[model samples]
Target: MTAPEPYAGVTTHTPVRHHILSVLVENKAGVLARIAGLFARRGFNIYSLAVAPAEGHARFSRVTIVVDAESAPLEQIVGQLNKLVNVVDIKDLAPRDALERELLLATLPVDDGNRAAVLEVVANAAASIVDVNATSLSVVLAGTPHACDLLERALEGFSDVELQRTGRVALPRLTQTESL
Candidate 1:
C-alpha cells in the first residue's frame, strides 16, 4: 500500500480529555523541580503549568497543572503527588466544575494603512490596546481559553505579529448562593 499520510492516525492515540490538578505546596526551593521531575521520569506530558503564591502567603504556593488523561490513570497521578513531602493538597478539578482563564498579549506591526483594520479585529475579540507606538500596537486580553485562542487566530492575519499566552490557571467553581 502507498505510504500512509503523515500522522493520519495521530488522533486515535491522542487523549480526548485533559486533567487539571490544583496542587498546594510549601513555597520552598526545589519543590517545583521535584514535581516536574516526577512527571518527566514517568513519561507523563504536562499540557500546561502555572505556579503562584497562594493567598498572599509566603509559605505556600499553588500550582495548576494540565495533564493528558490518557498518559496515566488519574488516581495514580494524585497518589504520586500526595507522596511528595512539599505537596500539601491536591484537587483534581473536572472541566465542568472549574473556572479557568488565560491571558493573551500580542504585539502587531501596524501602519497608517492597517491600523484601523487591526483595531477593529481587537475590538471584535474584546481585547484592549494596552500600548500604541508609531510602528506597533500591543494588545492584551484576559479571558477564557477559547476567547484567547480566537484572538490569537484573528491576529495571525497580520504580518509581523507576536503573541504570548499565559497557560491556564483555574480554581473550583463556587456554587450559586454560596458566599466566599
Candidate 2:
C-alpha cells in the first residue's frame, strides 16, 4: 500500500483555516529576520506579518498567518519560536471568538475619470478618503471585513492597480490574556 502524506493529519485533527499570531518581542534589529527565517527554514509559510511596538521595552507584532499544517509541525514551530532570544510571547488567535477586524486600504489610479466612481463606491462601502494625490488616493475604512473586500474588488475594475495593500488588525469579542 502507498504511504500517507506527512501533513495529512492537518485535515483530520484540526480545522482552523486562518490564524492571528500575536508575538511579543524585544525591540531590536534582525529580530524580524530571525523569526522570518525560522518559518522559512521549517517549511512554514507566513501569509502576512505586521510588527509594531508595544508599551515598555518589548514590542508586539500581530501576524496574520494562514495556519495550514500538521499538528506536530505546528507544535514544533511554536515551541522553537518561543526559544528565540528576544521572543516574549507567542499565541494563536482563534476565529470563532473573534469579534471585529479592521482593514485599512490604500488604492490608486485616481485620475479625473475614475475619482467619481471610486468615491461613490467606497463611500457606500463605508470607507472614506484620507489622502488624495494627483494620481492616487488613500482611504481609511473601518467596518465588516466584507466591506473591505467589496471595496477592493470594485477598485480593481478600474485598471491595473498602481499599488494596494491592507492593514489587518483584529480583536476578539471577549478579551483574553493569550491563546495557544
Candidate 3:
C-alpha cells in the first residue's frame, strides 16, 4: 500500500484555531438546526454562527460559522456540511487569500456621548453602523477576524454588547459575482 497523505492537516506545532465557514443554504427555518447538528455530531466547537437572507431574494441564505478544529478533519466537515438538504454550498473563507469578511454587532446605549467615539473607531476600522437608537446600536464591519477581535476587545468593557457575528462571509477580491 502507498503511504498515507498525512491526514491533510495533522502534525505537531500545528495551530488549531478559529475558522469561519460560509454556507449557502435555502432560506428556511430548521436549516440552521441541521447545520448545527452536523457540527454537534462531529464534536466540533462552534465559536459563533449567524444566518441571514442573502441580497436580492429570500431564496438564498448565508450561514457563517466559526469553528476550532485541526486541519485534518476540516475537509470532512465541509464535505459533510454540503450533503445537508438545505445547504447548497459550503466554503471556508478562513483559508483563502484575498477573502473579505464582515461582522455586525449590536451594543446597548448608542447615544450622543459615546456615539462619536464609536463612529471614530468605526472610521478607523473602515466599518459602518447601520442601526442606532437611544439605547442600542448595530454596526456592520468588513475586515479580517483580527479586526473584529480588536473591536470587541475595545468596546466590550465599555458597552453592553448583545454580540452577534456573521462568522465570516467572504468572496474573492477580484470576483464580480458576490453571494454566500
Candidate 4:
C-alpha cells in the first residue's frame, strides 16, 4: 500500500499566470511554516503572502497567498495544499472577482524646503500623514494594490524615503443582489 500522489490527476495546458489563493487553516504554530515549506520543496515562488485571524475567530487563520503560477500549475499548488492536515478551506480568487487591498506605511525625510511639496504629493495620493516631526513625515495609505503601487512610485521622487507594505488581502466581491 502506497500513499497517493497529491497531483496525480491534475492537468493543465494553459499558459502559467499569477494566482491568489485564500487559505483557511487551523491557527496552529507550524501551519504557516508547513505551507511555506511545501512551496519551497516544490520550487514554487510565492509572490505575496498575508495571514491574519479569520473574522476575529481565534480558532482559524486566513492566509492569502499570491503564487507565481508561472513556477507551477495552479492545480498542483492547490492539490498539494489540500494535503495539509491543518488547511480547512481554499479559495482561488480571480482578480476581477475579488476586492483586494494592501496597507502601505512610508516615512520620508522632509524639511522647510519640501514640506509643502511632500504634503501635496501625499494628499494627491489620498494618503494621510500619520505622524510629523521637524525632519520627517510618516504617511499611511490603505488602498488597492494598484493605488499603492502608484503612490510608491510617486514617493520615489523624494530622497531617503522608507516604505513598508502589508501584502495584499482579498475577499470575493459580492454581487449587488447578494447579501453577506
lDDT of 4 by residue, 1-180 (tens): 221222433233122477789999999989999999999999888988999999988999999998888899889999999999999999998666778999999999988777777787789889999998888999999999878877777776677989999989999888522333
What is the TM-score of candidate 1? 0.86
List residue ranges in candidate 1 displaced over 4 A: 1-15, 176-180
Which order, best to worst by lDDT? 4, 1, 3, 2
Q: How close is candidate 2 to the true structure, as a TM-score?
A: 0.69
- Cα misplacement distance, residue 72 of candidate 2 (Å): 7.6
Off by over 4 Å in 4: 1-16, 176-180
Go through the candidates in order and give each one's C-alpha lDDT.
0.83, 0.62, 0.66, 0.85
Clashes of each: 0, 0, 1, 0
Looking at model 1, residue 67 earns an lDDT score of 83
Q: What TM-score, computed on C-alpha atoms, does each candidate reach?
A: 0.86, 0.69, 0.60, 0.86
| Model 1: worst 10 consecutive residues (lDDT sum) | 1-10
Model 1: per-residue Cα lDDT over 1-180, one tens digit each: 221123322222114688889999999999999999999998788888899999889999999998887888888888988999999999998766779898999998888778888888889889999998899999999998778877777776677888998788999988533444
Candidate No. with top lDDT: 4
* Model 4 Cα shift for residue 87 (angstroms): 0.6
